[model samples]
Target chain A: MYKQNITKTPKAAALAICAFLALVTAACLLCLWHTGRSSGQLTAEVYLDGELLWRIPLDQVETPYTLEVPGPQGCCNRIEVRPGSIGVVWADCPDKLCVKQGFIDRPVLPIACLPNRLVIRLCPAKDSSASHAAPDAVTY
Target chain B: METKKLTFLALCATLSLALYAAESALPPLAPIPGFKLGLSNIVTLLLLRRYRPRDAALVLAVRILLSALLFGQPLSLLYSLAGGLASFAAMCLSGSILQKKLPLLIGAMGGLAHNGGQLLTALAVTATPGVLAYLPFLLPAGILTGMFTGLCAWLADRYLPRGPSS
Candidate 1:
């Protein structure tokens, strides 16, 4: 069964697959570079089930504080907010991936708790028109 | 299915489940959430190479269901089902076209598809677009891990005794 359906050029097929994946990797890297580049005032946005639960300007924050964000099925994620960074300090989810993600001071990535449906992201402050010029404008 | 084939597939399912459990026990390779090495995929790829797609699918379904019931939460079941189905589909497609030669390539594709499926599910469940940022990190990780599992499958297929094909 295998002999009859064997591809004519396995090497070529392998090359094609590698090339395609490499292209995808490159594109992803470009996106990473673009997203990681942030400047000026940064704001941490906490979301639950896609709704904006909290929008705290990192620059305006003088004292670090923790906020509890309620999630589905009585679960909650405790978010730790510092002057320049934010992270999930605790969560009731089984995986606790968001908590493990630690803190984020850049807009490069968003800490997400899949089980709790909570997302914490850092981006440019909406009020500052200069620094917000690019990152949010580009969508993947 | 023949009793012999059924028994062999059952064994495969058990092996995959064991692998899944063991892999989950280890510390995560990266800090990223939902990232995994997908070691259980070796069994799925091996099944695809030796038997039929449907046979591999059955084993995969069994492994997913059992793992969820045993070691995972209800919410995780959704992600597992999505990732498992997507991975199996990719493996089947690549295996059929490429035949048994390029297990590494097939596995890589499966890994990417699995992550893609899970990411999509995350988007829907959380309704958060910021989750998309994980894509850049996940893509490369998927390829590397997929290649590793595929290589393992290739070695196992090379050494293991042939099973009755359905």
Candidate 2:
């Protein structure tokens, strides 16, 4: 079978591999560009399941505090919120991936605990009225 | 299946499972969640190259199921299933078209598909679009790790003694 199917040239294989790599690299760049762009103000939003559990303005935090988020079947994640950053300090889940993620002050990536079904993300803080009026409208 | 063929595939499954367990015992490669070396895929790639895709799938299924039962939560099983199936599909498609050569490319494609599958599962399970931000970070990671595993498979396929033909 191997001998019968040596039809593809080595040059063609190399070109295909290069093309695939380039395509994925371009996509990675685009995604980074979209997520890395920072707005003037940032708000950290904590989510349990899909619902918005809490929205804290990262820029306005003067003191550090921790919040315990409980999920189904007694799973929990303890979040540490500092002046300008947030992270999961503790989690009851088997894999402490969230805690290992450390802290984030920017809106680039989200901290997620899959076992606990918890997600913490940063978004551009909107006006008080707009944010208050539609808490669920926050995009990611 | 012949007894000899079955035994060889079973041995492959065990080796892959060992690889999976060993990889998991190590510290997380990166701070980002869902980042992994996926070293066990080396076995899957080798199987696809040397045997039938069905044989490869059987071994993969066994590894995923047994590994999850031994060392993972219920939710992790879901993620593994999605990623494993998607990875297998990508490898089969690429291996068929590209033949035995260019395992690197095939492995990279499998890695990308695996992450994409897990990301989609995360989206559904968590119901948060914010997790999509992980896409940029995961894509590059998948490519690099996938290529590494693929190279390992290529080396193994080249040096290992030829077994009974499927």
Candidate 3:
């Protein structure tokens, strides 16, 4: 008799939750909108704890280069950069999410390793032409 | 404290661990970091409904610890512990405040808090403020996934046998 199944919640509480979920949905959409904006620079900026570690200009790179980023507690992430594209090729972390993210040529949400505190985002460069550079003619 | 109660709690813990393993084995639902279905929470939520808050908390702890030990790395254990504690705290607070009226809402909030805890841990370890950018995506994913897990609990509670015998 002490424990009755609580099959339903009050109408007011249910409405409040619905409203909260709707608000969260809106905020997520807005965040996505912010991340969707393309950067003017074609540089992949790697940040370690908000500090700029390396900025690879995708347009200028003639060959693919992999940079090892040092993280907290002796952790590290291997980020590969190529012409107009960048990605995490390897990382010493549990999730491996940054590595799974694959290549990113567009400016969007950063690929992050939470454990290592590493963030890689393609950001706009000061030289506007770099963002709109011609395709690598050498490959063709 | 009683032998019967302890055994029942242990069984619940085992079930929760199985759910945790099952959920982890599934491919990542999305590419976003830290996104999870949180299927194991089903046991915790159910325990919260069926037993006292203390029982629910103990079951949650056992599941988190056992699953982490069996399948996760040390660093992962730390992250999950942080997230687990945060979510557990959130759930307990919500249960008390709302008088267990809305497990769905509590689950959503707990999910959000879990992500927030992980995000904080990430920020602290990496000392990177940029990680905050992840919140915009993580928070929504948590709410959605939490609701799913919450519904799973609700459904299980509604159908699962009640009382200690069941």
Candidate 4:
């Protein structure tokens, strides 16, 4: 009888799923805000899909450069670039696993998807300390 | 009675092994380890329907060990054990709380409990508190997968005829 009375329609399930996703999105935004407060300078340019989309001069500021690339609109996989690194910030991929993956600041941290044909990277200035690690990159 | 119990255990083991092998051959889901549907759960559903809790427990222990051996992923036995045991416990507990027709909820609870158990084990193994941040993300995944596996079980129970004894 408990099972008979337990009304679990798909609509209710879908609503619950939507609510969970909203919570996750809010959490991600909260993390970004937390990181943004202690931000560093942007001293580089980012390229995606073989195009020069963003440029940041080291002397300009000490804030992380955040850029959004234009592509298939509404998709999150557009490349994101900060002073010290670059990565794909958003993609319309089904999994959204890339979005779940936050920024990568290491020189060797590369985020890519062969199926989407997307690539992102941070190019350091010629005179900047190559000894230091690259800037941040967020793959969506 | 012993002969019948042994036969059921053997069948469950075979099912678990087949599913484990199939899953092992597939590439990792993303880069994270130990994230999957645990398709061998088909056996769990079957047991929940056809056998008693004690029988279900025996099947779970045997399946986890046999699957771990088959895959050579012995290091993952701790994870599997924690997840499997938690899942079984949850299923048994929820079975009494819910109904025979509500196996999906049982499956979902089992999945959620299993992931929680796995996360606990991961913390112990890796000695990294940062990894626990992944727990919230996995919760919804567990519920979703649990619902799916539970649905499969529900279908099995619904369409299949009751045993002669019943």
Q: Please write out the lDDT profile of model 1 over residues B68-161, one tens digit for every residue.
A: 8998777788989999988888778777667567899999999988988888988798676766867898888888899999999989988998
Worst 10 residues of 2 chain A by lDDT: A131-140
lDDT of 4 by residue, B13-102 (tens): 777678777877786564334567767786787677777877777778887887766664555677889998888887777675554446
Per-model C-alpha lDDT, please? 0.82, 0.83, 0.77, 0.62
lDDT of 2 by residue, B1-166 (tens): 9999999999999999999989988978675778899999999999999988999999999999998899887787888999999889988887776766789988998998898888898889877676676788888888888999999999999999987789
**Number of backbone collisions per candidate:** 0, 0, 3, 19
- State how far residue A13 of model 3 sits from its true place (Å): 3.4
Query: Native-vs-model 2 lDDT?
Result: 0.83
Question: Native contacts retained per candidate?
Answer: 0.40, 0.36, 0.31, 0.00
Error of 3 at B29 (Å): 1.4
Q: What tens digits encode model 2's per-residue C-alpha lDDT throughout A1-140?
A: 76534655545765776698779879898777765565657888888886789989988988999999988979988899998899999998998999999998767778989888788988778743333232221110
In candidate 3, what are the lDDT values of residues B74-119, reduced to their tens digit?
A: 6677778788888888877777666676688878978888888988
Candidate 1 residue runs with Cα over 4 Å from true position: A1-7, A38-40, A43-106, A109-140
Error of 3 at B4 (Å): 1.4
Q: Rank the candidates by DockQ, best first.
A: 1, 2, 3, 4
- Candidates ranked by lDDT: 2, 1, 3, 4
Error of 4 at B128 (Å): 0.8
Q: How accurate is candidate 1 locally (lDDT)?
A: 0.82
If both were scored by lDDT, which would come out higher, candidate 3 or candidate 4?
3
